[model samples]
Target chain A: MLWACLRFPQLAFDALRGTLPNTPGAFAVVAGPAQRRGIVFANAAARGAGVRAGQAIATAQALCPHLCLLARDPAAEQQALGAFATLAWRYSSDIHLREPDAVLLEVGASLKLFDGWPALERRLRDEIARSGFACRIAAAPTACAAQVLTFAHDGIALTTTAVLQGALAQLPLAQGGLESATVTALHGMGLRTLGDLFRLPRAELARRTGPAALLHLDRLRGHLAEACPRWQPPARFARRLEFESAAHSTTALAFPLQRLLRELELFLLARDGGVQHFVLVLGHERGASTRVAVGLLAPQRDAAHLLELARVRLERIALPAPVYSLALQVDELPPLTPPHRDLFDTRAQGGLDWPALAERLRARLGDGALHGLACVADHRPTHAWRHTPLDPAAPATRDATAPAPTANRPFWLLPQPLVLRTAPQRILAGPERIESGWWDAHDQRRDYYVVELRGGQRAWAFTEAGSRQHWTLHGWFA
Target chain B: MFTSTADLFALDSLPASTAWPVAAPATTPASAPASVPAARNTAALDTVLRHPGIWRRRAPGTSALATQPSGHAALDALLPGGGWPRGALCELLVEHDGLGECSLLLPTLAALTQARRRVVLVAPPYVPYAPALAAAGVDLRHVVQIDAAHTDTHWTAEQCLRSGCCGAVLDWLPRSDYRELRRLQLAAESSGTLGFVFRPLAAADQASPCALRLRITTAMNGTQFELLKCRGRLGGATSLRLRA
Candidate 1:
């Protein structure tokens, strides 16, 4: 019934400081791109050099001369975080991403099951080490207490009342963790110890220090709730495959994963669906396995498309250890009915040979490679098409009326026209100018037509209302 | 007959970007032939050389269309008529020329634009080209057109059809297979638009997807266009053509 909050105290900055040398110099990690490589992902090294967090890159470099720069690999940290989460998940199901850089673990139920308080704390610390994170771990009976302890004692476990009291007594209230003026008031009152604040009557404290001051007292005493939102569990399309013998080779692991993947596909298929996003659990080595998750830009049903996308990501996945079992999970998927508008039309025209076709195309061409053109709701002929992920059932939109070109129009438009007739010109046919805009830019112009000699070919073209010089080839009579 | 190594050495200089300033204009190689060049098309299109898989399967497998047999043996035999012209465009008009009635053409249109072919419905009455075409295995990518003829939709479509891009072209105008139809038919013959006219559901007769004409309707699936006005040898329609 109770939730335990475990927290990491300034873990990112602390991790940076412990590693970086103490020099009055700024250093940054430069990993991803060629230019502006020095924008600090973790800037604690520069902080000591009077280069504050979020300071301009130029200023940071100017302030600190001998900065030990490592390319900032968010991908690397993200990857490390994933491995960390899997290890953390083994400790508890209630895991929240406080960002890829941090996590929140709810371990109230875990404490009782994992032996007594000290043992539980040791186990949590051991698991953090096991995950390859030189992490600072803090825990308390209350989420806020654990959170405060994590920040207060730099990851020391909070258990005994004296230890808890000691931790809370020294923790300062800042950034609403402790309100302003209250700290000043407390300073003026000469009350630095939370133990000093603890002695005041609860009602008197709320009245004298102002209502906000009560929050610090409440949080320190575990009266305030841990305000972090809980993670939502994904819908279960997950099925696990347990083997009698633990498999270690890639092919063997793939066999089990593929089987689970098929079931996941069929389950999603039965739901008339496909998964664009999913999580993976590898519990093959008897409760010890890696978990890799992926979020796709587009939802897909075809297994190959998902697999190739998986492969690009998985190639980077060096297995933490060998696999024994694998679990495939899919989330947030729309049901994929037989590629038909009406569900009942078993006799509907053309069986979904196209989806079969769609599957093949998705396989050979990377998922992102073959995209259907989504028409942009714009009057300009060139801006008419956009590459949208091919969703057969995507709602078809009716195009608004376009201005009838006064010039000869071509069989196909070359996306954008090198505006030949920029200026307004006289017309041969009726002057019909089309101007439309709601979600996009409107071209309000009286399109007039004129014929001009280009490369010795008489080209039909159109011009805007005011400009008369820009003329574009509309089409050939041929 | 050749190994990869042998083939490489036997060839002329390898294709490379480095020699572009000089090698760019050497006889404009397309005028001659290469051994099945994978790359063909305008240089500009090359900038957006849409990877091939989306265009079509490298080699189309068995045509997905299961075209039902038309009564006319000669025509049915000409087609794998059990299915429409798979992978090819079959244009149908709303007028009868030599085919007895528009009904006769249904099975064929049903066949060519059938489920296997992935039909593309060009121009039709505002009824948003029938979904029933799908039942026929017509993989019509979409029902799109510059319905507004203000621009050159016809010309644009002509280019598309001549490019052998779609499975068919269905123009609903009252024009019979006159000069342009002849031009289009000749154009279709090589480029692949299996042109047919759906003469005013009750127009005279013509020759098309089927050799015989029939009165086809939603209520009565398909009936023979018993009175034939054209299609010389098998001029008269005597039997009911099945609509798949």
Candidate 2:
């Protein structure tokens, strides 16, 4: 198996840069704000001024008077790592996150699909660059050796067992991620390079150190395989962002909501799916949560479209209280079907873009504002049809056995039949009787006829045949 | 050269400069032809034949404009360019709400809906009888109804038309101003949707910006259609009949 390891040496600094647009000066990411705070990461400019990692905050400030310090945000670092893992997953399914800064990918199975090692490496480099991360990539026969080489070199691919062993032999024994005491002992014993340590007898190394050192060496050299749990995408997308200050208005929430949506878009794109239903929960300071559910007629993954829909829905809502946190959850993710386009036709036709327009209208006008017409198989004119919510899954078509309309059905049917006081001047057509509806409530028995009024207007009027001889105007004919 | 007032004003003594019409650029070599004609017979016959407004001799009722048949031959013949004018408003004025107005437009709506294009009905007087629409061959899935109040009726209709997703939008406006109608017309023209507005017959006396306006009234045998305005024909001259 071949493994590629990508190490982010300046994860703390890069995380800040990825989140904010314009960050000035050479700042160090400190571990904490209290008594235990120390510089965990420093940029090149800060290093030039004598500030380095593992230095006390006071000592760093004394060395570089203008050094800006920022507290390390573990949440942001974890989010950034998740985003990178999603990017790696596009090329290979077997990927593991090496914490604080690296992603390990088992790419042996994906080499053929990406046209072998050279092309795959090139693609990985280009995609990482596009994602705005500075990574040092190295490949080896095992994940452990690849991770170690990524820290010291750039783009080193050791494919076969001989090449891996040769590359590992050239590395200094200090770079094997051993404790400082062990490295010092090795140095005192005059073992500098990994080759020197390997040349020693196995019994002698165990006598010098313990069996843990030997096991670590074996795992690094591919002699022993360790279980590297593969990262799986979460079944549903649920990301929460805590605001520094409570957001009092919807406009204030847009920025953070946009970041969450961008992440969701990347997540969906990696899985080749689209979201149909999602909910936005606003957490209030008083422990109450306001949830806004946004549903689309079609599955959509476009960030701008989803944001626009969210904005419209948010406008109509009255916030219960100031929100301290916001969470986005999506439960329904349907596979996206690419729209079919006619090769010969070049016009921007109305096949795919209409759903976006419908979604936009729905967002503004509110839910239940848009619906399609459906015909029920009832004999009563008022009970004949109903309004159905529009669905994108079902294409527009009529069932073959859908009841064929009679020739004389009126276009307009009154909700309640208007009682006719006077009789008609001329009888134009039928005394057709529609006497159904004994099964359900509101039974009706009447003799319906088409008669013309004195103004030469034809009307569909029905007369009760039971107790009362009352005439009612049911509808109008063309 | 003589230095005198006469030398400056004398036509014969002064050197002639190149005139504006015949002046040639120094960079452009004299080898190239001069004075290319501004006007040329660049109109191709194929494009002319494809133009929607132009009439062709091959067919009697065919024009270049794409048309959805009205499902009534008599009404189709009465309309200019053979069928309903696309991307323009067709105003149908009636005395009352339910005087066969919906029936007149149902055929066209069904045809558009059947073709998988959306047909939105905005602010109808009553619920659309779905059984009747389905029976008329309309794809029920594509027929959307927007419930808008009187204040938001025009705005909703304009938005639906401007979306370009709907093949047709039918709006029943109880009262509308001339400006609103013009805006609706412009939206329809820009989005390429077939627009139909049902207005009161009293508004028919006022001039409209619609492409086609017909006064529909109940006649002896059936519904009568009087063409009030057409794109390329004289208005109020033709009357067509449809069976009841």
The fnat scores of all predictions, in order, read 0.00, 0.57
Residue-level error in angstroms, candidate 2, position A40? 3.9
Q: RMSD (Cα, Å) of candidate 2? A: 10.5
DockQ for each candidate? 0.02, 0.31
| CA RMSD per model (angstroms) | 23.1, 10.5
The number of the candidate with the highest lDDT is 2
Q: Report RMSD for candidate 1.
A: 23.1
Q: Over the stretch A1-478, how does candidate 2's per-residue lDDT look in tens digits?
A: 9999988888888887855547567788999658879999998889999998999998999999999888888888887888788888988899999897999999999998999888998988898788677889998899989998986789989999888888888899888766778889999988897778778899999899688888878888888987968898666899999888899999898988898899899889999899988999999977789999998888889898899899888887988899999999998779988655458742234432567767877887767788877777667777777777777777545655446665676667777789888888777777777788888876977788888776667788888754235678887764
CA shift at B185, candidate 1, in angstroms? 60
Instruction: State the TM-score of the second chain for every model.
Output: 0.42, 0.76
**Model 1 Cα shift for residue B112 (angstroms):** 47
Q: Report the alpha-carbon TM-score of model 2 versus the true structure.
A: 0.82
Per-residue lDDT over B139-217 for candidate 2, one digit per residue giving the tens place of the 0 to 100 score: 7878888887688789889888887778899999878887898899878876778999998889888877777789987
For each candidate, what is the lDDT? Answer: 0.47, 0.79
lDDT for model 2, please.
Answer: 0.79
